[model samples]
Target chain A: MNHIFSFFVLGGIIAAAINGKIDVVTTAAMTAAGSAVQRAIALIGIVGLWMGIARVAEKSGLIDKLSHLIAPLFSWLFPSIPKNHPALGCILMNLSANILGFGNAATPFGLKAMQELQKLNNDPDTASEAMCTFLAINTSSVTLIPTTLIALRASAGSKNPSEIVGTVLFATTCSTITAIISDMIIRNLYRRRKYN
Target chain B: MTSEMLGESFSWFIPGLIFIVFLYGHIKGVRIFEVFIEGAQEGFIMAVKLIPYLIGIYISVGIFRESGAVDILVKLLSPILKVIKAPTDALLLSIIRSLSGPAALSMTMEIFDTHGPDSFIGRLASTMLGSSDTTFYIIAVYFGSVGIRKTRYSVLLGLLADFASFVASVYIVRKVFL
Candidate 1:
């Protein structure tokens, strides 16, 4: 994180100097920060809206029912999670929120899932198979709605703001499928190399 | 399904989900209003907490784009990108998409502004942004929070997934939109 941040900042400044865009960079700094705050404010609206609904769904047992609807798939994906484990529930909720594209709502659930998975870690410093698989799938983002993109397109005055939803579904599905397969393959390879 | 049909259904999906949430809450006797307010407040807090992260990324990305460095990298990678049949315009987006959520949004917004949101590049950018999470950031935060150092092949898997997402977005956008 530290290196990437510094690298981007320093590299950009150096490149600006060579490209004689120091003035542009100076202007960008101000405008970028300004836009960042504006974007955050806008985020507050959507995040608040979805998280609110998610909370209601969670409290009303809707989310639980939804999780149960997909529990079989979760179990298959995370066979290592012990039956009735809290981490499994957390993982389910997290992935459900992710698939629904309620990303802000997903983060808390994901963090909770990580902590629960941590308790199951035999090697304190090493990531377990379940942890790796969870993180891999989480990072892959199996979103179905992608509310953010749709909202952005709407604001940008697209003729059909929601049109990307279909493409996003296809794209995210591909990534998630790839992530799961790769996780399975690499972990097996890791186990074989370590044990043999 | 046609894009228009898919879009209409999805557009209804959100409102349908919201209505079902409310109806279910009412049926379950949840303090629907209060719970919603509480969750909404949490959302405000989360958004506030994310501001610093967003500013940090936005500034760096803004400077990087302003400096023309991104364009240079795209140029240098054109041969390989061409060989792979990847859209050169989306190269920086896919790289930054994995690194920073806010940065990727900023890039997508710029693309939309430059190309018009209905254009092929704009639609492609939209799909790309929605296609994958910020893989590097997710790994760093999730594993870092757990204090796990030996992350093994998760990072590789995550990037591979990200690559798959980009390729899928490009292919689907071409097939459906172009």
Candidate 2:
């Protein structure tokens, strides 16, 4: 994190000098902090609302029910996990929150899921097949509605702010399928290499 | 239902699902309001923790874009992009959207201002933004949070997914919007 952060900041300034856009860089630096604050504020309401809903769902056993309903599918995806593992439940809720565009709420659930998976890990330093698979799924999880994108479009006065929702659904669905397939293939290859 | 109507219905589905959960919690004898407040508080804390990360990434991306680095790359990549049938202006967006979320968003806003929001490029940008995650940022934070150092195939698969989404976004936008 530290390395990438400094590299981007320093590299950006150096590149700006070479491109004669040093002035632009200076101005961007001045406003960038404000933009971050604005971005964070933008997330508060959406995050808060979804967090509440997720809590309701979890406390009501809705998440557990949903997980059980999807257990057969999850079992295929995560064959190593027992059919009734808590990790399976966490993973389901995390994916559900992500699909609903509740990214902030999804993180805690995802982290909890990772932590639970970690407990099942035989190796501490290296990522397991399950962890890698989870990461892939989380990164490209299919989102049904992209609220942030829609809000941005609407605020920009687009006539049809929600028009791209279909496109997002299609694209994310494709990517998610890609993620899972590739993950399974790669994990199998790694397992083969380990045995060899 | 038509695809557009299906999309709109899904948009409403989230709120409806939440309401159902609320009612279910009430019937199940769970203290909905109290649990909700606790969860909201956790969300706020999560938001707070992300501030520094968000600021750092946004500023770096802003500087990079403003410094014309993005322009140089876009120009260099124009031929390949044209072959892919993607707009030249969207090159930066496709790359950065997988790298940093705020940076990509700022770029999206820039595109919206430069080209009207209804333009093909604008819709394409929005779609790309909506479809993908910041691969690097997610791997960093999630892996870092769990103290996992040796991330063997996670980054590779994540980038592949990002690439798939970018290609899918462009293809969908062309087929649907253009």
Candidate 3:
């Protein structure tokens, strides 16, 4: 994060100087925090709504049902994990929420799942194979609906805003499959070697 | 049914999910209302905690955009993108989407404005935007919260997924929409 942060700031400065876009740089820097705050504020309502629903989902035992539904698939994917582990439930909830396009709702569950997985980690500093796999899958999660994309397309005046849904689903599924496969390969490849 | 057809009824999906949960909780003898409030509170607090990180990343991303660094990167990567037959217009969106959501949205809007929404480039951009998460920002938030400094191969594999999504987006768009 630090390295990437510095690269953005320093690279931006150099590029702005070369491109003579100093005004844009100054303006953007000035409003950056304000814009970010606005975004966070906008997020509050959505987060609250989804988190509430997610909580209800948890209490309702839907999460358990979801875990059971995906248990076979989870077992195959996360062979290192035991069947009834808390991480398995959390992972199932997170992935289900993600598929529903409930990103805000998925995040807390994802964080909780990570914390649960961390409890099983032998090394505290390095991410475990399960963590890496989970992260990869979460990063490219398949969604049943691409709501934001549809909204964007609609606002842009597309006659068929949902036209790309099939493509998005297909593409995300491919990426998810690739993420899982590569994660497994990388995990095994680096298993014998110690990463410090 | 195709997802597009499902999209037409997407409005009910969330409410249906919530109703089902509420019903289940009631049947299971859980305090649905109280639990919902508790989760909502946590969500609010989480949003508050995210402010600093969000501001920091957004500022950096804004600076990156204003400075034209992304433009330079896109120009440099365009040859490779061309070799893969990705629309040149989507180069920035695919690159930035994994870094920052808002930045990628801006790029998507730019593409939509220039290419028109129904155009092949516009649809490709939209599909790519939908398919991937902001990997770096997610890693920073999730791992930083856990105090894990050594990320191992998470970043590499995450980028691999993003790469796969980008390639798949291009191919699928060509096959389905073109």
- TM-score winner: 3
Best of the two (2, 3) by TM-score: 3
lDDT per residue (tens digit) for residues A26-142 in model 1: 888899899878877887787677667767877787756655666677788888876656677668778877887777667766765776789988998888899989998999998
Q: Please report, as a residue range, the 10-residue window in candidate 1 chain A with the lowest summed lDDT.
A: A62-71
Tell me the interface RMSD of every candidate, in Å: 5.3, 4.4, 2.9
The DockQ for candidate 1, computed on C-alphas, is 0.53
Q: Give a tens-digit lDDT track for model 2, residues B89-168.
A: 66778778766676789889999998977899999998888888887667755665456778889988997888788889
- Which residues of candidate 2, in runs, are more than 4 Å off? A1-17, A20-63, B1-69
Q: How many clashing pairs per prediction, in order?
A: 0, 0, 0
The TM-score each candidate achieves on chain A is 0.69, 0.72, 0.77
Ranking by lDDT: 3, 1, 2
Give me the overall lDDT of model 2: 0.79
Candidate 1 regions exceeding 4 Å error are A1-71, B1-76
Candidates arranged by TM-score, highest first: 3, 2, 1
Q: What is the lDDT of residue B89 in candidate 1?
A: 73
By DockQ, the better pick of 1 and 3 is 3
Docking class of 3: medium
